[model samples]
Target chain A: MMNKKTAPVGVFDSGVGGLTVAREISRQLPDENIVYFGDTARVPYGSKSQNTIIRFSEQIIRFLKTKEVKAIVIACNTASALALDAVKDEFDIPILGVVIPGARAAVEATKNRKVGVVGTEATVQSGMYTKVIQGMNPEITVIEKACPLFVPLVEEGFKEHQVTEEVIEYYLESMRSTDIDAMILGCTHYPLLRSKIRAYMGDKIQIVNPAYETAMDLKCLLEENDMANDGTEGQHSNYSFYVSDAAEKFRKFANTVMPFDVPITNVVNIEGY
Target chain B: MMNKKTAPVGVFDSGVGGLTVAREISRQLPDENIVYFGDTARVPYGSKSQNTIIRFSEQIIRFLKTKEVKAIVIACNTASALALDAVKDEFDIPILGVVIPGARAAVEATKNRKVGVVGTEATVQSGMYTKVIQGMNPEITVIEKACPLFVPLVEEGFKEHQVTEEVIEYYLESMRSTDIDAMILGCTHYPLLRSKIRAYMGDKIQIVNPAYETAMDLKCLLEENDMANDGTEGQHSNYSFYVSDAAEKFRKFANTVMPFDVPITNVVNIEGY
Candidate 1:
């Protein structure tokens, strides 16, 4: 049996977007080995229904458990919003999602008592951030808008393109009129477009990235549970990547953005899980 | 077994984009019943690999066959380009893809011998259109560009929006510089942006929508194979709709654009196949 303290942390997303969260975890928990899965085959869960999202999430969790992970993180915003609650208790290990941590960070950053959220259609429709933020404090007013094209724009490598700036203007023009002091980059893919988003929204509006906060939450969780990996094993950590489809694409994209080099990527038929 | 002359035709796409093709079929063959399947759960097959696309196409074809249809039409251009050849021989029924018909039409429409093709990344990368067109006429020059954002724009109901026009400009600017007299709207969703595409490309450049040509080809296939549905049953043709997920959204989108009302839609777990 694998030691509970040294067992790898499993992280998953619908596609390569979740690498942002994985990178954060790697930065914060340098000694911990990581097993990351990207469901590139049935990706863009943002447009899918709640039932379907839940089903996909459950399948991924089941797959992750087989990796002997001590804990799991739902990195995709859509899956975190729609699937976390339903499957969190089904497994024995600790399960974390990106929504609450981001929501908490947004609540703390907002000086004007108003917070803005930009996410996928499913995440916005779920109103998970608003619910979580308001549940923490009822006084904060949450403004939510679904930027459906942001993910595609980011995935297509149009993060800083003029066309992407036009699209940002198209989606965020109305939101800019409000007095929100902080905006949460609710979708994992949003961080890739952070520069474009920041330029359009201006510096006054604090941009909160959940990946950072989620990593903090994860650190606290490990400390509280005594599941943190000690450095006695080794200084170098093992990071394995498994995607449902397009391993080469995932590797290429990861190498471009990730802090470390992803030398080998395995393709798993996630549907069977 | 169902009567060959009275059985419906199977039309399948990656998602609701194929409704354009289904609507065209309804107009061209008013008497034939149609069974349409939109893999809404695992859609936008454009970014996926050839093996994954082929696997998905096989699954959809198996599901459509269960509906007792006389023939099947691969309405999505990406799947047509990547999957059609692999799966065509496996099934006994006549299977038609949009690429050949569209290539033929583009070959005939381009008087200057310079033809433009716009599609998803996979379709353009496959170089299927260039190969088919050049094979048909050795002298024709094919210009292929992938407009990855068009589908998301159409799906987001931004068909006539200014942002879509900007994106259209972003993708088509280089193509416009060339002397191509005709452009193929290589993806099914592109037809929904016909007005904007036509406006930007100007009046002289002919826009060829493969949906219409594919429908005409379906008509010819039915007639050639003696599979045409006789009108003795009734004028009202039964059109059944199935999707992998989001049945309500499919019905709503279909009702808005389809020639006939889609009163009932069934959700099938296509992954089970």
Candidate 2:
């Protein structure tokens, strides 16, 4: 069973935004190999419906399964919000999504009853945050905003721009009007636009990022499953990134976002998947 | 061959941004039925590489060809820049990309012999504008900048925000330093942010939109080939939209941008193509 510990973790996202989650997972697990698939060809799954996102998630999981992953991480919030259960049902291996872990982290971090969620349109539409937060603490009030541009802006490398700041302000105006004490960066891409979002929300609003929590959860899962990699100090761990289209761009994005460089390859044409 | 004019003119893009192009095509050719495919599933193709964009363009063309389109319009700037030749070569039918039409228009519009091109990274990096312009008039100076964030900001509906404007200002600052008499909004998504771009460049700079030029080109091509739609006067032209994923979002975008409402279907998986 322990041999499975080193079997490698399979993580997939619509595009490079999942690198945030991958970075966290790498930080927490350190020793295990990670096989990351960014469906660059068919990215931005956030605006897609539950049915389409679910179908895409199934195909991605199936593709990842071929890589012999012991567990699957649905690093996309939109996918997790709409398709986690569908994926979990379809796959025998343990699966984790950014939503539940993020929701749980938000619940733990929020001192006031009021909490806000900002993500892509699909995430906001699903009311996943309200459902998950209400399930955890029935009396807590949840406010959600669909900042549809955040993902695209981040992917386009608009990390800190005046226009990005203004867009964030416009999108967050409703959330700011509320008495929310904490906000969840519901989408992975949202974190890349952190300075703008935080500036808009101000210091009082505790921002919850699921990437960190998901990483922690992944560590727990590996330990529980006896899938922890062999302990050796300063051992090199391998990471391979696969994007459905635009491997060159994904490689450039990897250099821009992550601290350590990981090689990116284009193998899948996810249009059919 | 006149019977060929009865067939629909097919247009495809990464997302709803293509609606700008489609709307123009519709306005110019009221008699023509338009079949549009928005690859909303994997959008923002601006930052990808030449090879991936080429592959995507070919796949989209293959799908459109199945509908028996008389002509195909690549409404996307990145795809046009990177894959126009490949697409034209792959299909036996007449194919038109926005670049040549836009380039021709920019050449005509420019009086100072200095032209600027603003688009996605992929479009800019391909240096398509330089090549196309040089091919026409070697004396025409070309300046290009990759306004990567523009597409996301527009899709997010922050076209007129202070922050978005500021980001535009930052991206266009270098262009402003040059003596560009005319600027080509190379990416379809850029037109959505045209007002802001115009504001930054001031009134002196003429903006050449390829979509508009493409519409004119399509009209001319139909007239030349005698394949123009000959539907009865006052008949409503219909458009059918298909996407690899996110039919609903495509519908939302179409409703927002197109002159007429579009019914969307997610019919083909691109991987198989």
Candidate 3:
């Protein structure tokens, strides 16, 4: 039998983008430990094929398995959208994906039932959000746009930069006329540039962050499954972070995006798995 | 003895950026056959480690060797900068890199002996251009800047877009003070943004494209080694193209970057090599 009370929850993204997810999880469940893996070497999973994405996801999962995680969260939207269903049954532990939580959030937040989704090409093309949202509310309309350059813009540390604003406008210009009440930041990287996205979309539209909802969903799952860590509320725990390549750069980027400093980040060879 | 007169020449890049190189080679050596490989799966080699770049370059070379190429041209600036010297002696056939030709062109074009170089992080960090140029002219001043976002901008087809101009200005701002008489477009993808780059740098500072010089060097090397494809000038040769992932997308991007259509691009498992 596996010990669930103290085992860390595993969270992974293609790269630093997923730090937003890990940060949310840390804020929502302070006592619980988190093991975050960023595949920086073969990043931008948005452009890779489903098979390749699944293979890369499986390798990351296999590596996470070594950490004895109580649950695994697919923080990267492209991986969750294209790969989760294929590997969900293979693992004995709980497997959570961001798309369902994100979709649910959008469905709940959108009063007009008109929603826009912006993500990587792979995520939008997967039709996962549309399928999930439509399944929940039969009449809700979904407009999905693949903003490929957004990831690069965010990765290049251009959150509030004018160039990033220009790119956001370029990708989202048509969506302004669509009159969507709510928009989903479907890609993990998109949350980092939320201010610019919101500025471009106007104040009337609501922005949904999958990371926050995913963390909440994980917390609910932990309680329902009786797998919640039983430690005191203020229990101190060390969060372990790992990346496929360039730990130093990942750390610096994490510190820039998050409120706290990333003290120790390790580099691991993900291909071996 | 190798039958060089009828064999194809090999060219490899990290992704579609190298198509610019292949196109240049076609313009310079129309009768010669070409074999191009784009490692789209592991692209943006600008940030990868030297060891990984060399490993990837060697695998690509091995795959290209299977095509029976008489010579190999590393069209990618990062690969040519970090991996060439390590693999130059491993192969018996003629091996050439873009860095040398680009450096030579910069040295020849700069009247004030002051030159500026712009490329990917890995290529610029490698100091290959600075070393080669300084070796040629010890008194020449070389300033190198790594414009990391340039590739993604070009890949997104933002040649004349406002964002592209902002990013170009953002990257080249500091170099305005260097008073360099000439600037080298060290990365293959850069030539696509020549108009924007030239406009920003002003007409006085000459822009040097390594692709032209690299193609010319390849031509010279072929004739010097008696390996020139000496069949009739109108001899036909199929230009084969391969990528590690997304053949269809690569073909589309090729058409956007190059003047002609890429009829059929094949996908290969570069890791297996």
Candidate 4:
């Protein structure tokens, strides 16, 4: 049996956008093994309903459990916002979602007590970010907007295109005019368009990426739980990727953004779980 | 028992985009009942692999078969390009895809023997349109480009927005410079952006909508098979809509673009099939 301390950490998202979170985890915890799953077959969960997102997250967690993961990270913001509460307790392992970490960071970064959040339709509709931020500090005001086109723009590989700049201006026109001192890139895909968004929002507004905060939180959770891999077991850290759809496209995208070369990717029929 | 002549025609798409085809069918075949299924849960099949697209298309077709549909229309361009051939002969009923009709219309409309096609990534990669057009006339040339962002732009309700026009210009710049006399709005959702596309392409090029061509083809098939509904049985023509995800969003979108009111929509677990 694999030692619980040496077992891999499981991370999942609706699709490849969660790679941003996975990359942060790899950077923060270099000694830990990571098993990542992307449900590329039914991606962009930001526009889906609460019930569907919850169901998908549960299935992914169940699949990760079969891999004997010590901890799990709900890397996709939409899933983190809508599904984490419903599935977090169903499993015994420490499970962390990006929403709380993101909210906390947004609260800390804001000087004007006003924060802006841009995410998918479902994430904004759930009001998860605003709820968590206000729950921490009632005086803080949260301005939420759903930028449904960002994921498609990133997925279409238009992150640096002129039209993407135009799209950013179009969606953030109202948010830019506000007094918010910090803005949260609420969707995992948005981080890929960070330069464009930052360019449009300017230097006055700080940008918060939940991927970084979620990785920090995961590190603390492992340390407190005594589950951190210490590199004494003669086990070398390894990274494995699995997606619900074709691995070629995912592998190509991952290689361009991932910290390490993604040579092999596995395909899993997620619907069966 | 439902009479063969009175059975509703089944039309299916990855999502609500197929409503364009459904509306066209209603206009051309006024006496016929219709069954429309949108796989909203696993939508935008444009970027997915051929095998996954085929599996999803099969599940949807099986679900529609339970509705006792006389014939099926693969209203989604991605599915029509990738999945139609694999599943068409598997079912006893006639299954028609939009690719052939769209390609035929482009061939007829183009006087310069050159045509342009725009669709989802899967549809363009499938080369179904190019193959069909070139097969009809070896001398003709087919220029294909995948406008993956168009679907999301339309879904985001940016049909009349200026950013859409910019995106249109970006995607069609090279095509506009070409001498292709006819351009096919190959994807079903594309009809919503017809005005923007027309304005960009200018008056020199003719635009072909596969929805209209597919509807005309269906009319011919029904007449040839003597399966046209004559309303002689006093069975009032009715339309029913079903989706794989939450019905509320689908109902709202359908109400906006559909010719008739979508009073009630049902949700189906498409994975169960």
Index of the highest-lDDT prediction: 1
Q: What local lDDT score does residue B164 receive in model 4, on the 0 to 100 scale?
A: 89
Looking at model 3, how many pairs of residues clash? 0
lDDT of 4 by residue, B1-273 (tens): 778799999999999999989999999998999999999998879889999999998898999999999899999999999989999878888899999999899889999899999998888998989998998988889999999899999988798888888889989999999999999998988988998899999998999999999999999988888888988988768999999897998999999877778879999999999
Choose 3 or 4, whichever is better by TM-score. Answer: 4
Q: Candidate 4: give the clashing pairs.
A: none
Q: What is the lDDT of residue A64 in candidate 2?
A: 83
The list of candidate 2 runs beyond 4 A from truth reads: A193-202, A230-236, A255-266, A271-273, B231-238, B256-271
Looking at candidate 1, what is the lDDT of residue B12? 95
Query: Each model's TM-score?
Result: 0.98, 0.91, 0.93, 0.98
Which portions of model 1 show Cα errors greater than 4 Å?
Answer: none
Model 4 spans > 4 angstroms off: none
**Cα lDDT, model 1, residue B52:** 96
lDDT of 1 by residue, A11-31 (tens): 999999999999999899898
Model 4 alpha-carbon miss at residue A229, Å: 1.0
Q: CAPRI band of model 4?
A: high
Q: Tell me which of candidates 2 and 4 scores higher on lDDT.
A: 4
RMSD of each: 1.3, 2.9, 2.4, 1.3
How good is the docking of model 2, by CAPRI class? medium
DockQ of each: 0.84, 0.54, 0.62, 0.84
- Write down the lDDT of every candidate, Cα atoms only: 0.92, 0.83, 0.89, 0.91
The TM-score between candidate 2 and the true structure equals: 0.91
**TM-score (second chain) of model 4:** 0.98
